[model samples]
Target chain A: MITFYEDALCENCYAVRLLLHMLAVPYTSHFIELYPSRANLQPRFRAINPLAELPVIDDDGVIIAGAAPILVYLAAKHAPGTWYATDTPALAQVTHFLTLAERLSATVGAARRHESGFAPTDLPAAHTGATRLLRGLDAHLWFAEQQGNAWLLPTPHPTIADLACFPHVILCEEGGISRQPYPALRRWCDRVKRLPNFLVMPGVFLTAPPKTE
Target chain B: MPDPTTANLWHPIAACADTPVGTPQRTTLLDTPITYTLHGEGHATAASSSMLPVLIRYGYIWTSLGTPTADLFDIPEYAEPDRRRFNAASVSVHVSAPRAVENFLDMSHFPFVHTGILGAEPHTEVKEYDVETSAERDEVLATRCRFFQPQPSTAADQGAEVEYVYRVPHPNCAILYKSSVIDETRRDVIGIFVQPVSQERVRAHMLVCVLDDRSDDETIKRFQQTVFGQDKPILENQFPKRLPLDPRAESPVRADRVSIAYRRWLSAKGITYGVIPAA
Candidate 1:
């Protein structure tokens, strides 16, 4: 049985879960909340993943650390034709998107942790980082619309790039980022919402007893 | 605007704006958007846009029907398309889910998800799918995705009929579909897009279709039943979460062209397609 570690609300974890579901590959989930894990701080968890992230999937001896790599690896092995590019040149493009995606994860992930944590934040630095990331997305989307939907490469199908970018983009609202004015994006979301085997990220419902209650 | 509609035909629907509140207008569903309010008492306006009108000499129009109680298939009226379409084509889907309704055009998932229907290979053929949008192309109310199945061998002709006609999102956002290949006269695809009104409770709309050619309605219904029957459990079981990509971490490929193009389209339109860009 494939056992993947994850948190309930972690954005990247949710992206991974969505990917697994789309592939229709069944796996066991091991909920490992990142907040204050005294027990999992043991050497075993760290051994599985050097970063100690939420989604360190342990499928037998084949341990996968990051959500991005793990997803591509899992899908490549299980649902190869759908998302993976068997071709060499396309693999390089996938690598580029993955690299950029990792940088984004680092920036957005840090900012989110900063907010979720009751700790102090370097406000100006955070803002600068977010602005830069949003700027790249803004230009990319704008240019794509002008071209009537030509991609970085000609795709015969939807690849990991589409799946990888989904979760964080939706969650950016948590950091006060709104994608309202982008008509092409709104339409695209409409399209994503249409695909089968899609899953929305789950989070805590606002209506809950106060800590005291 | 005098005769401003670019469509070759003039399809009229009920003008809910003109109708008084609480009164159900008898309207034909004109490609669904402008549900024709039939009763001359209400508005003769939403007449047959279809060159044909079947069951819709009358029906109720809701200014705001947020959720239906059960699946559209469970509805008695959905059993009869002739009554509603007045001989024109019509289809109903159960729920108003944004995703399931849209999958008809989301050709990306076919290889793994539905390998039986769509052959397991990279189909590089990028033909145009017509979108019926608002005058400004902002609102894609409907789309016509067309594709032809390749001939398997020179001896045997390899052409499979493929067309997924769409209607834009309603309050339910359920994906509704219609097909012309099943029968030139076939109306509607089976299934209703269902959404949960509460956590576990669902609202649905069942669709009926009239198959074309000599194949009776029963044969078409059986075929549809066998096919869509397989998808129901899987989609419903996929609740709560999906495979996460963390684009920040994964690589993309040329085969992802449609997905990449879609992502770009989304990011431009104010839809946050991924978090990688901003971070």
Candidate 2:
């Protein structure tokens, strides 16, 4: 069984949780308190991961740190073809999106933490960076919709790319980033929410069910 | 030229179900922190430990930072016995209260923001509607508004051309009367009552009064959450955060008749709170 060390509100952690639930992977949760008292920064946790970043997963005692790496690990092991495209070009695109996800974590994630008093940083700078990222994401999704492609990559199903970026985009308002101007981004979120076995955390919400016969 | 007693207006601070008996709930109204308790009747205290005016109506706990200049506006549909009356989840938005109200009064964004649920593409045109300011009631009313909705409500299962009536009775509160799926003769009521937590922060409380026996609270709540969830990000993303009352600040189209009337009404009333004053 995978022992997932995570914080309920952490965006990176949510990415792992999304994949775990989507793949129907059974895992045990080791909840980490992130606010008021930063449990992740403690010495005991430092022993597990010197970086002290959240979302370190222990897969049957095999330790893994960082969200993207863990996602790649899980997909390569469990549902490789559907989630983590192994082909040359698709693999490159997945890697590209994972990098964007890290950028989202640095900007939108930092802004949210600052708003919650979890960390202090330049809020305006974070907002500016997040806005640029979201604008690019919106334009990409708009063009994708024009081609009848729903997911981040032009695959029939969603990749880790969608899962990696979904949390921050869904929860951007908490960090003072608005989704209103991005119609395509909002539509993509709704599609992601309608995915089978989709899980919702506290901040993430469920969309209306798709039309059925 | 906003009224000096702008803070005197009543705003919904909490849902009735949220503030339980003997449990003091902390909330904000117009940037002032308030604590409230419901022991049969509702009582509230400001952060300054002074007693604040409270009114429990429309399934929400209304509070004022100062004495209200007028009584709380009426939603007679809320008193309807057969209606499935409930408070949809309260949403904290990063936009000004006036901006939230203005969005509620708009239908043009439905095809885009709401997509398949409230509206869809290819049916994007918002037909002309009648809008007027009721002098005696001091409210902005838009009548004869119609739109093509894929699913108008939780009870709706198919597409329909929905008729709508919008009322802006207060600066931060807007109510919608839409054609109902259950009872076509009667309109379902949806109200967005905004509490201005600060210049660019608001807690939007939604009240739904509809004649639908097919769906329960959770089903209805989920539908409303889905709809508002789509709007929240857009509301936060709007430039300037606050509603621009100046006609020149943002461009408008023919479909924005109700929104234009709402801005005109706010301008005439000199409501500057949560809005950019016309220069």
Candidate 3:
């Protein structure tokens, strides 16, 4: 059992929520308001994380903050060798993409918050940065598809890295970032949506199932 | 008059292996789109509005948007019998060429950006290094920099302290020579050649020449690709797509000596194709 601190519209929280559903882990939710009264600044939430960030998890008293770290911990503890590999080099490669996912939270996630009136930021810079990230991700996925590797890492399984990055990229349209130009990324997003126990947030929708011949 | 920055420098447009015989490859250099085909006799013909010189070297197709004053810089290691050269796939980035070149010259981001592989959080400090511009070769060089890597190369089985030297021979090309794990005396040379597709776009071609016999060609190429894949998002999302030329534009620390020298060199050369003019 886990206690997930989440918000429906928060991209980071969406990643955590998605992972929990995919792993079929039972968890209770603590809904936190991101705006209009600022519930995250409350004393109860501040006790959890000094920074008061979203997507925190309390896995039976093992409290973890931040979306990336919490996802890593969950995958490591709950679904090891499945959602996360235990090998050193494979873990290192997953860490690389996890770091990249944090970058996406800063750039693409920031842009979405600004566009949706949830936060204030340098909008133009955020948009530019988000576009750049999307372009690189598109290229990477294109090559990965070419090499017959479907996930972010070169394995047959989807790791926490893919779950960490998927939320913001799929919801980027709300921030005025389009997925039309990235054919490979769009296809990859569909593949992720088709994963077992996948859940959808407000801005993200279920991808159409592939047609059978 | 043609812009001297675009006219007098050679930019690598595509990999030789990517441009097979009789197949036309299309790419952009300095904002001009051109299509060229390689023939059976080792000659290339281009169909464009203007004529441009082309050269094939180091497994890359080099072209100029204007008249070039000098040939491409030489890497003597290419002739060494023990060295193996690899031409990795080109990465298309949405940042200016100067920005990409500057990022390649920077090593401080290894820990915070690249993380576990290139560096770890506890070993984040970058020791002081030496930076100088060679008058003879007209290139920016940085030496004596060192960092601890969990996996220095694809073939490495353990962590090692890697010595590094960086060179910026052209406004858009940066090369790195790092100590090799397999060979105690020899080092690995990697070149990043950025082609300025437009004012705010670039395509980076990476060439790895190493003396390691431990890893196969596919392994080497995949490792390089994975490393570069880690850098792509960071490079693209950097604010101010065009690099700022002013020393005061962005704050710099001791670890940024290479980036400072490279920016200063670009400013001194009067290159403005992909740079924000000093305010």
**Residue B236 Cα positional deviation in candidate 3, in Å, after optimal superposition:** 1.3
TM-score per candidate:
0.40, 0.68, 0.61
2 or 3, greater by lDDT: 2
DockQ of each: 0.01, 0.07, 0.03
Query: What digit string (tens of lDDT, one per residue) describes model 3 on residues B127-232?
Result: 9999998878999999998998878888689988899999888889989999988888888899999878887877788898887777766566656755775676
Q: On TM-score, who's better, 1 or 2?
A: 2
Candidate 2 runs further than 4 Å off: A1-165, A169-174, A177-213, B41-49
Candidate 3 residues A37-88, lDDT tens each? 2557889899998898787888888999998888889898889987888999
lDDT of residue B6 for candidate 3? 55
Model 2, B48: alpha-carbon shift in Å?
3.7
Model 2, position B184, has a per-residue lDDT of: 78
**Which residues of candidate 1, in runs, are more than 4 Å off?**
A36-40, A118-121, A146-153, A181-183, A203-213, B1-279
Evaluate all candidate structures by whole-model CA lDDT and list the values in order. 0.45, 0.84, 0.81
lDDT (Cα, tens digit) per residue for candidate 1, span B170-252:
22223334444434454344333332222222223233433344544333332333334334333444432221123443355
